[model samples]
Target: MKLLSPKLLLLPMLCWVQQAAAQQTTEALSDVQKIEYASPGVRGMGKPRGIVVEYERLPQFDIDSKSDDPEIGNGSARVRRHNKFSVRALAPIMNKPQTKLILGIDHSFEEFNFENVTPATYSLYNSLEDKNLKSVGLQLAFLHSPNEVNFYLVRAKAELNGDYTRDNINISDYLKTTIDVAYGWKRSPDFAWGIGFQLGYTFGRQRVYPGILYNRTFNDKWGVESIFPANARLRLNVSEKTLLYTGYRIEGASYNLLASNPPLSKFNDIELRRTDFKGLVRLEQEIYDFLWFAVEGGFRQYYRHRVFDDVGSRDYIIKNDLAGAGYIGVEIFAVPPRRFTEGRKNK
Candidate 1:
């Protein structure tokens, strides 16, 4: 039990989208009508403008036996599921309207299973049953506005994580890098805000964080979208082809394992950090004009499932439970023609 708590229904939808953006503005507002009333296009609820393919499943995800590893002679550790598949692409390669450039590619696949173990967890699923996790990512985006209410964003990303079955693939030892910048303000026609700083280099140190983003639109059926520590949502517009959301997200990954065997063969390389915290409910429809269909359900809170010993730094823990999951997705996108950003409408 104990579920419901999407920040308590997102604080009354963020106080009604900040009092409906301060009662529908008062002068000075343009920047393309304040970025179209601070987001409600690209199919509302943000994130739309190119490619994406998603798949997720968490069948069971249970494995709680609390072990400080005394050869796990009992207690628990069965884990029979947990899978994911993803593919994403975002491309715009510069399409001016006050500066814009984008290019992105991401790939992911995570699998975990035990098939029903027990021999004291069989040495932790026989060292993850021939490990070979995957991750590939790359992104570059820059968008500038300078007018229409100010906007600026810059991003750079790269990630190549993990266990390619037994080592022997060193793209600089499985890289991970990120850089981001932000500065946006629409502050009128329905609010908007941004601030940023994100520079990272995972698992081997180097980090710098600080971020905030916002979007609001209280009319057309409620709204609020955020990206702080990374994720937030509360949008409900069951019309214009449906939509509904209630969110929370925080997912992590950092893999690169295969230190030979037996408790990580004295260590030289082995790192598997996984984190999760989700509580969601999503729904989106729209079945034409570029297609869309989504359905989600969740509650899989298990922050961290560790394993580290990059040459004896020492760390181990494998089961952090609490699970539930379901999702279905399909999206084919490309938007921006409501008479070219909402104009000519008379017939």
Candidate 2:
């Protein structure tokens, strides 16, 4: 089954099962409703996920660092350790057959620890040691089915990413926002397509781009899900309890960082823009009634890593070219009870 559209892809669980089970007493859904949120009796979307959490500690990787200023002189850079943590939850604000409103929240934190054997070099590298980045986001997803065959998907998200502590946090300096709206058609229970415009920082900066969301289920064992230009995955249903996926994903972000010590003492703050493109494989297995665990491994290619003045007083100050590195992550999430979904299917 397909996940959320590209705009709302940050939270990829499709749990409308309880809603589907409750809808058994209601009339048939229009074409859009069936495709956007599949009926339980149909073999379309999968899972009734509620909460998801992920953690990863990427290994030490070599990095080649350069700067717009040659006088700062540097030798090499290495990321000694990188730790990432994230969590997300989704709940229905309003659920109906014709219209659905879902609210989701996501929080993420990351730490980059640089290996510094000798401190006699570049100022930028000195300041980059032990840097931290954080983000908290809110998203509202709206699925509207006006008629039988047509549907619309609208999603908006606002995030704050930065290095500021609780004492000095400023909303105006760290807020980043995005919006995605697409028009889709339900050709059948197992196929759907849509096109939409996305305005956000998917490439480490602000830009507007068009995307095509295509989902197809070939059989009980095979499926494909994608939002073009951002993500795509091939799905394999090995059994009722296990699932596998191999796909591509792009991650991008801009963080406002504090300027405390040397090197950046002149500026109030600096901005870090980064993007990563990866191809990966994932395996998901049920752990208990509603608990599931997943393991993912991938090779990440750095697309952009740049630094600039936050006040827009100057052009980019630094650019680093990072080599591709292999990465791995693990996750645990909650899905609806099997009894509830099975019950809906037998209806």
Query: Looking at model 1, how many pairs of residues clash?
Result: 1
RMSD, every candidate, angstroms: 16.0, 4.9
Number of the top candidate by TM-score?
A: 2
Identify the runs in model 2 with alpha carbons over 4 angstroms from their true place.
1-45, 70-75, 116-121, 311-314, 343-347
Candidates in order have lDDT scores of 0.55, 0.67
How many clashing pairs in candidate 2? 1
TM-score of each: 0.32, 0.86
- Winner by lDDT: 2
User: Residue by residue across 1-347, what tens digits does model 1's lDDT show?
Assistant: 11111111112122222322232222233665533323111124432445556666666555654446654433345566655666666655765545656677767666666655555435545666535477777767666555657666767777777765333777777776667666767766556777766664222233565657777768888877765665677888878667798987655556666655455455567666655567788887766654566777766666555565561245554444444454333344443333432332121
Expressed as tens digits, the lDDT of each residue in 199-233 for candidate 2 is: 76666567786777677778999887777777888
